[model samples]
Target: MTEGPDITFVLGTRPEIIKLAPVIRECEDRSLTRSIIHTGQHYDESLDLVFFDQLALPEPTHHLEVGSSTHGRQTGEMIIRIEEILRRERPDTLLVQGDTNSVLAGAIAASKLDIDLGHVEAGLRSDDRTMPEETNRVLTDHASDYLFAPTEQSRARLRSERIPDERIYVTGNTIVDAVEQNRTLAAQRSAVLAEYDLVPGRYCLLTAHRAETIDDEQRFGDLLTGVGRVASHLEREVVYPIHPRAAKSLEAFDLDVPDGIRIVEPQNYLDFLSLEDAASLVLTDSGGVQEEACILGVPSVTLRESTERPETIDVGANRLVGTDPAAIVEGADEMIDRDGEWTNPFGNGTAATQILDTITGAERREVSPK
Candidate 1:
């Protein structure tokens, strides 16, 4: 069974790699020739290269060193680079994951060049246009040829936007696949628990990198104080993997990180998986972390006012506590003390195979679109 070289996956950040790794393995198993292109969006060695190595994904066929820039500038630069790569690779379909500048850029390049675009983690919407990710998701959705929605809610969102229902497939969620697979491996091999001097359920996992929270000095100060407040109130250690931008913002604002809140550099995907698995509760402004925590059945308090993945809240898997110290303290206290049992509204962890099956079937049908 010889499959054609028909897909090129676009990955830039650690989250994209985590969610896409299973799909890449599935493609390899089915012998569907695939190429991966890395846009150096998050170019740090620890964050980017470590994921490729740890996940055992093939070294990217191409790397477009489009480092950090303004949304318009970064995406615009990626469009040019991706278009160049598309010309050289000439794959039948271009695959992108999540809603990032990279995803938007890849979609725009692929669609304009008449290459079929497959968007994994589609149909997610926070309805907060002020956030760049919302804009990326909307633009990428309309441009994609195949939309792999992670849940029923995402599918409903696509239909409302007039995207053809026929083009959408509820392929569970690829992130859950990553979570399930990695947790198993990490449980067996991770020493992070010992290194951090932690006991299970005794600490909170914290990550906040969103511009909305960090870009505002007052809000950022509240976040630091709020996490400190939670740690102080609960007498729990708060393990934070500080994003580079977030660390700089802290220094810029002259906000002193208090004791008992352990601030370390950003972790690679594996370290994060292990850390999250061991946490009593999770706190973040990340969309992906919200779902990851929910699937792991760890209660999560989102620092944002709203989330694109409303299913988390719907299933009581997560809550939005915003940036207020009092609210964060209260939310953390309640979630930490509660019993952990919430139905994962995301999926049962078989998303990657389903996505590939649907895509392969679609490729066959295109021969006779009737």
Candidate 2:
């Protein structure tokens, strides 16, 4: 057994943790030598620590403690800190998921250190460079030695960018794996529905945390107005588990959340899964929420003009209804009336196994040369 450190998984934010939980479990199940590095991008105990317990994941081996800052400052700080950890640990391969600044920094640091880097959820592009995540996705995909695409469309996007075919593998998304693995647990353990007095398939779930949407005062106000209208029209409360950042922006901008929108604190993975699973419709500016809603067979209304997860839209499970109040209401009505029979295009919950197999196989090929 060639055994120093074989692989290091780097992530930050709740979505990264939730999506990566299954992969970490797979590593544990196989007794693979693996380490986790948490960047601390989301330092809130509710958003960060609660998830580790909810998902039953072990504590991260390295905590960078890189709290929030300007985009450039935060990404720069993470690159410096992660590079130091990579140097000290000298793992054979570094793995990063999604397009957060943490992923960008990990990709950059590993590339500079000449370490083999694997990017999970690679090749997703919204084609809108204005979104910070879009830039991160494109840059990390180019920097990565192994690109684990989540779908055939994502792979096609990479080929169009001329990423070498040998470097790309269409591993189904791990979000499906996470959802499938946790749905039953969520139903058994979560009291969110009862706490909120919500009936299954009767309310709309809302999440709006994207920087572009929340940072603009006009856009934020419009989104609130639109969602409020939808709620009034449907005569059902929109249960919004507000992101900390969005909450801050709301207060900073002096915007009042409209009536008919019930705002609550952020939720742990299992609790949030319960909300997503039970909602008749989901409205959000979050990519992960859009994907989850699709996998759960709930119709979703995306509050953005474009989405990297177009697979959801293609399968008729999601609709893009920007921030306009009228569009939001119309889209919500349309989605709510639609049948929830769209087949999930993500996968059959085996993405983590395939990802681990690919990573270990690549490590073996690398060790054979030495």
Candidate 3:
């Protein structure tokens, strides 16, 4: 008997790895042949190691080493490398996630080559093309043959764009699955809390690394200063598991981590999840983290002007605090006082199984034409 064609999972940055790990495991358990292709857009070995080790994901089957470059150059190199891999593997389908250059590259290459494309974290939009991720997410949604939206808001965004409802499914979010599966592991095994001499629910977890937030000197300074001021005012430690880019930007801006603010290197995924679970509130510019915080039932202050996941805001799970330090401090205090009463709007954390079921069922129907 012949084996099935492999399903290729494309991932690059840290968020993609966290969000897609569960689906990879699902495919593995089903004995469906699969390949995880890393595009190297993140260009950080530690970033890759943290997710692989913490999530227990299989080492990637293919690494393109596309690395950091201009947006166009990075996306172009990924297109060429991924196209080459797809040609060689000739997989039944390519799975990409979220709104990143790597996702766009994989979708473009796969669609052009006539391979079925699956988009996890699909149907998300900020309606702001100035944010490259918004453009990436929109384009990938349209190009994909299967769209696994994490929420009804995500689904409606795709519908507003005239994408067929049949092509879309509300599959919740795999990050929630990762968070749920690992929260216990994190509580049991994590030393991250100890390393900081920290206690859960006593501090704010902060992470800001969006290019828009970091590229502008004033904007980035506002983030650091705002977070610093917020920490000072709350009389609470603001733990920043700093992204490499965010760290570099802070250095470039000569922004000092004012007294009482803890700036640390990126924590491994499990450790970070544990921290998120314990935090009094979350302050971040990451779209995925916003959703993760929601799933963990924590209030979040998004440090961006706009968010792709406004559903969190709609449900009172997150507030857009922009880059203003005063607003940041105010928002953080409001959330702290409010004490996160809102329920999680993301899901009950079964996203991976739903996503896999949707894609494989579609493939079966396409092949077996009823």
Q: Number of the top candidate by lDDT?
A: 2
Order of the predicted models by lDDT, top scorer first: 2, 1, 3
lDDT by residue (tens digit), candidate 2, 155-237: 99999998888788888999999999999999999999999899998899999999899999999999999999999999989
In model 2, which runs have C-alpha deviations exceeding 4 angstroms? Answer: 1-5, 362-370
**C-alpha root-mean-square deviation, candidate 3:** 2.4
Indicate the TM-score of model 3: 0.95
Worst 10 residues of 1 by lDDT: 361-370
In order, candidate lDDTs are 0.86, 0.90, 0.84
Candidate 3 pairs with clashing backbones: none
lDDT of candidate model 3 versus the reference: 0.84
